[model samples]
Target: MSAEIVVLLVVFVGLLILNVPVAVAIGVSALAMIATLGHVPTAFLMAERMSNGINSFPLLAIPFFVLSGVLMGQGGMARRLMDFAAAMVGRLPGGLAYVNTLSCMLFGAVSGSAAAAVSSIGGFMIPQMKEKGYSKEFAVALTATSATTGLLIPPSNIMIVYAVVSGGVSVAGLFMAGVVPGMLIGFLLMVASAVLMRVGGHSKAGVAQVPRFWPAFFGALPSLLLIFIVLGGILGGVFSPTEASAIAVAYAVVLGGFFYRQLGWADVPKILLIAAKTTSVVMLLIGASQAMSWVLTYENIPQMVSEAMLTLSANPLMVFLLINVLLLLVGTFMDMTPAVLIFTPIFLPVVVELGMHPVHFGIMMIANLCIGLCTPPVGTCLFVGCSVGGTTIARTTLPAIPFFLAMLVGLLLVTYVPWFSMALPGWLNLF
Candidate 1:
């Protein structure tokens, strides 16, 4: 590596070790490297790189999705979705666990945020699980793991970031690719919960039984229709992902304010403020990441990394396995957004050289990073779940073991079975 690249890497590590916020760390580190190189005008570089980062049309999807998720989250749509999910699965062994998984899946469809899912769904169900005799640690663990489904499901903001960073790959296609695999992950989690409950000799909670299918079906209809509207619009090409997000916001307003009667006029300002705040944070990160990415490209860092990886493993399978192990380790230390931002450019070319489709790699990468959000030492989703469930990190980590295994299985399936990420997009000719 050149002196600039070496200094850039050092600055990044040093900033991170100092516990600087990720966006600032990235921006400052890039700036430090640029200054050290003294090869470019700082003002010109700053404006150009920042503009390049936020200039994509597809990137407009981020704010819309953020607003839509905020509207649904604030309007109490999650509660209804959880009620429907609980009704459908609440009678089985480890009923609340199943409910947690299913609810996260449903909530993921709408929210596209793991933290939001855990806060809203886990807040409601963890207490219920505890009351039903489920251990507090197990409840927290299940909720944390299931919340990761939000990253896998359609409408994921992280996927939008990946698409933007990956040279304008289809956001709609990525969304479609995520659907089946996301559900599969959720399903496997449920199965794991079932097996774990049986092994631990845990019985049904015996809470007030759900009435029947029809009631549950009707109750969940509004949220289900929201999913159909968003996904159908995207898949059918009726709207771009950005437009689809606008539609989602409108739908959430009607459903929450009018149909479900959960949200009122009084809630509008707070919802807007929340959405705006979230959009600002995400957009700033995107802008800063763009600058850092530009610096990396200018330094030929991606090419160097790709060449190094190729030398390390000529076999494609070995290369992929090695990438997975690296990503898992990175996920443990870094938050998902920065990880995706910093690594996507570096890894995309490596995968392409190994004859992997960008779409497949995108899904696999997102899922792997999603697992990191639940891992220890800095797992954002795990911390959120623990807080919501009123448990400690140590307690929650035990229950996370089985769920982690289930996610690993899903990750391997997506990695090896390319069709899991490609079938729908291929049929639709969306590549």
Candidate 2:
């Protein structure tokens, strides 16, 4: 690496260690690196880059999806979805645990935000699980880990961001690619929950109020329809992902306001304000990340990284393992959005050179980052989950071990077996 690259990397990492906000850290680091170059004006170019970063047509999907998720959470859609999941899995050995896992999968899919899933689904489920005699630590751990499935599922903001960073590879293709792997992770989590439940003797807590399939399914149908409408429209070619997000917003409004009667005119301003604030944070992060990415690219960092990775391993599988390990560590400290922006450019070409598909790599990258959302120091979902469950991170982290392993296993399958992520998209000709 050049002196400039070294300075940028050091400043960024040092700021992170000092607990600086990620967007500010990235923005200042990029600016500092540019200053080191010593010929051009940093302010104007950085301003233009930040503006251009959030300038993509596809990026409009972020705010719409954010609004839709907020509406769905406030409209009582999450509870109904949980009811449906409970009904389907209510009689299993670890019934409520199954419900928790599946509910996160469903809610996360709809919300497209893992933190939202943790808070929305966990806000209800964690209390209910505790009422049903589930261990508090287990409840918090399960909720935090399970909520991560949202990032791997469709209508995911992370996936859209990945698409933008990866040179606009099909958003639909990445969404399709995520379907099986997302479920795989959910299923693994379910199995782990079931086994742990049986071992801990908590299987009977949910039997007293077994949920019926037809009733729960009917109750959740409208909520389920949101998924079908947003995802179906995309898969059926009715709209692009960005267009689908608008439809999502419209549908969420109708569902919350008219159909469900859970929302009212009084709620509009609050929801808009929340959405606007969220959009600003995400867009600024993207802009800062874009500027940092440009600096790194300008330094030929990706080329150097790729060449170094090749030196570490000639075998494709070994190369993948090394990359996965590095990414997992990265995820532990970095949030998914910035990590995706920063690393995708660096690692993508390495994998592409190894004959992996971009869509598959995109999905793999997401799956790995989802784990980070459930980890400590920077795990957004984990923090929210512990707060909901009324527990400490120290206490909750231990119980989360099995779920983390389950995610890693799912990651391994998605990484090595391309079919896990690529099959549906391939069959549907999304690529």
Candidate 3:
């Protein structure tokens, strides 16, 4: 490696080790490399790249989606969804566990944020489950693992970010590709939860008393309508992803603030403020990561890395195995958004060269990282789940083992079975 490239890696890794902000670590490291190479003036090039990074029209979706999630979460939507999920699954053996899993899938799909799922679903379900005699560890582990389904489901902010970083690959296609895999993961987690319940002899201990389906369904219908309006419109070609996201904001407001009458004018400003702060962090990370990506590309780092990966194995299965293992480790330390921004550019080329579809690869990357969301060190969902479940990290990790294995199995299924991701997009002829 060139001295300049070595300096970039060293500085970036060093900053991350020192616990600096991810955006600062990326921007400072890139600037240091630019100065070391003595090319263009560091300030001018860095400024140019940073501005250019967030200039895309599609980037607007992040804020709208985030605002919608905040609105839905703060109003009565979470409780309504919980009631609906309970009605749907409450009669089964280990009913509360199924409700927890299904609620996370539903709530996560609507909000497009696993953090929201963990906080919202876990807040209610964990206490209820504990009252029903389930262990605190089991409640937290299941909630944390199931919440990650949001990342794989439609209307996902992470997928929007992936589409932007992959140079305008279809957001619609990526959304289509995620559905089956996301549903599959939800089912696997439910199965694990059911098994855990049977082993603990809690199968019949706390059966939920569900209301009539019609009553609960009608109660939750308004909040549920938001999903159909947004995703159905996108799939039907009625609106672009960004337009759907904008409509989601309006719908969430009307449903939460007006029709439900749960949220008032007083709540609007707080929601907007939170959304703005989150958007700022996400946008800054994108810009900084883009600047670093450009520097690496100019230095031929992507090409070199791609060549090295191919030399490891010409076999497709072995190549993906190695890639999945690498991404799993990467998830341990990095948060999802910055990880996607930084690593997508690096690995996209390698996978495409191996004749893998970018859409499939995007889903694969998100699925692998979903496991990390429940892992320790820096997992956001992990923190939220533990906090809400009233358990410590060490207490939750052991119970989380079975669910994590279920996630790995789902990841492999998505990775190896192209149809798991590709079928919907193909039926829609999206590619």
Candidate 4:
């Protein structure tokens, strides 16, 4: 690596180790590297890059999506989905576990925020699971791991960020691409839960006494309709993903505030405030990551990194494996948004050279990072889940082992089997 690159890494990693905010670490690191190069005024150039970073029309979707998630979560969408899920699978052996998995997947489909799912669904499921004789560790671990499926399902704000940074890869196509892999991850997590139940002697403990399926489904149907509206609107060309996000906010307001009546008019300010805070953090991360990307591109870091990886292995599978391993480690410490923003520019080229579709790579990368959300140190979902469940990370991590393996299995399948990620988008002519 060049001296400038060394300086950037040292500074960035040091700041992160010191618990600095990720956006600040990235901006400072990028600015430091630019200062070393002495080619231009670092502050002026970085300001321009930061301004340009969040200047896209596509990024408007994030705040709306965040708002919608908060609104739905506040209204009782999680409970309705849980009720519907219980009605669907609550009679199976170890049914509460399955209900937890399915409810997270369903909630993820609508809200597209893993942390929101963790907080909403985990709060309810963790206590219920504990009451039903499941361990607190198991409950929190399951909730944290399964919630990541939302990122892979539609209306994902991270996908929007990817589409923006990826320089015109279709948002619709990326949305379509995530469907199967997301479900696959959910299925594998379910399988792992079932296996844990059997091995741990908890198999018959989780049967729930839920209402009839049709009634539960009908009750939850209004909230569920957001999925079809946002995704269908995008796929049908009635609107862009940004417009669909705005529509999702409107629908969430109507469903949560009017139909459900769980979210009172008095709740509006708090929801907006929460959404604004979340959006501000994400937007600042994007802006800083953009400056970092500019520094990387200006220094030809992408080419250098790509060439280095290719030189290590010319075989596509091996190169891809190396990339996955690196990303998995990155995910362990970095939050998903900054990780995606900083790494996409670095690795997209390597995958493209191997003849991988950008849509496929996008899904693969997101799936890989989804696992990170449940890990320690910087796992956002893990922290939220632990908080909701009233457990510690150390307590949850051991129980999370099986689900982690399950997620790894899902990630590998997504990595090797192009069809899993590609088939739906292909069938829809999205590419």
Model 1 bad stretches (over 4 Å): none
Residues 1-431, candidate 2: write the lDDT tens digits. 58998889899999999999899999999999999998879999899889998899999999999999889888888888888998888787668888888899998998787888888888888888888888889999999999888778787899999999899799999888888999999999988887788888886666447678899999889877877887789989888899999999999898889988999999989989988998988999999999988998988999999999999888999999998999899998999899999999999999999999999999999999999999887899999998988999999988899999999999999999999998999999987
> TM-scores of all models?
0.97, 0.98, 0.98, 0.98
10 residues in a row with least lDDT, candidate 1: 203-212
Residue-level error in angstroms, candidate 2, position 4 = 0.3
Q: By TM-score, how accurate is candidate 4?
A: 0.98
The backbone clash count of each candidate, in order, is 0, 0, 0, 0
Candidate 4 least-lDDT 10 residues: 202-211
- What lDDT is obtained when candidate 3 is compared to the true structure? 0.90
TM-score result, candidate 3: 0.98
Best by lDDT: 4
In terms of TM-score, how similar is model 2 to the real structure?
A: 0.98
Candidate scoring better on TM-score of 2 and 4? 4
Clash pairs detected, candidate 1: none
lDDT of 4: 0.92
Candidate 2 segments exceeding 4 Å error: none
Q: For residue 278, what is the lDDT in candidate 2?
A: 88
Write candidate 4's Cα lDDT for 1-431 as tens digits. Answer: 78999999999999999999999999999999989988799889989999999999999999999999888888888889999999999988899999999999999888888988988998889999999889999999999999999899997999999999988899999988998999999999999999999998889976557779999999889988998898898889899889988999899988988888888878888988999999999999999999999899988999998999999989999989999999999999998999999999999999999989999999999999999999988889999998999889999999999999999999999999999989998999987
